[model samples]
Target: MMKLREIAHSRTGDKGNISNISVIAYKQEDYETIKKSVTPEKVKAYFSGIVKGRIIVYQLPNLWALNIVMYEALGGGVTRSLSLDTHGKSLSSLLMDMEIEEEENEAN
Candidate 1:
């Protein structure tokens, strides 16, 4: 299973309940694999079963990586968790659970 290292994470905005997340490769070389793994479609798929919101993906030219921002996920500004909730879903868990198609892997 592929593993992702969380480089940074934070809320979407001061009052919004959304989660904006950033992650990178544990090993810099893994950036290619990570880029191959994460796509706009994959980002949408990642949050499909667990979160209800809009997911935006952008490529980081400088880093050869990607970033996904989950908007309006925490039920707007009404609810926020204090504990594990403070942390979005585990990066490792998300990567492990992903279903990467064979064709995509082959293209990489």
Candidate 2:
């Protein structure tokens, strides 16, 4: 197993109750591995406790990145949320911690 952070980095943004996170690969060659491993369903399950709505993933192959949009994830936005991370800035870190199966060659 390998953590997503081993080959990628992430950034996050928020609007209302929605959160947008971008997972970017350090090398274009690793983009396929990230794409194969990181699915919307997995992301939703990983954040099930915090995300109340649906999750959408957009693949940006040219940029070697994936855009993850999650709804109702902010506990009611920055103004209304009682959680410490109202803006959800720390979500990217949480996502980076997700473990994925390493490619066969990489595991060797």
Candidate 3:
């Protein structure tokens, strides 16, 4: 097992109560591993407490990235919410902490 952060980096953006996080693998070869582990269902489950609505995962094979769009996930919009991480800037780091089973190679 390994933390997602070990293989990928992320950036986050927000609009209203939605947060969009992009997870980019450090190596192109790692993209497939990330794609297998970082599904919308998995992400939603990982952030279940904070994500009250739907989660959407968009694949960006060209960039070796995955964009996870979480709807109604901010507790409320930044302007209306009193949460410390209003814009959810800290969410990216939080997401990177998710653990996943590392793929085994046949060569092993």
**How high is the lDDT of residue 17 in model 1?**
62
Q: Candidate 2 lDDT, tens digit per residue, 53-83?
A: 9999999999999999999999999999999
Candidate 2 segments exceeding 4 Å error: 106-108
Candidate structures ordered by TM-score, highest first:
3, 2, 1
Error of 3 at 87 (Å): 0.3
17-63 per-residue lDDT for model 1 (tens digits): 66555545555655666667667577767667544777776667466
Candidate 3 off by > 4 Å: none
Specify the highest-TM-score model's number. 3
lDDT of 3 by residue, 16-41 (tens): 99999999999999999999999988
Candidate with more favorable, higher TM-score: 2 or 3 = 3
Locate the minimum summed-lDDT window of 10 residues in model 1: 6-15
Instruction: Rate residue 15 of model 3 by lDDT.
Output: 98
TM-score of each: 0.56, 0.95, 0.97
Candidate 2: give the clashing pairs: none
Error of 3 at 44 (Å): 0.9
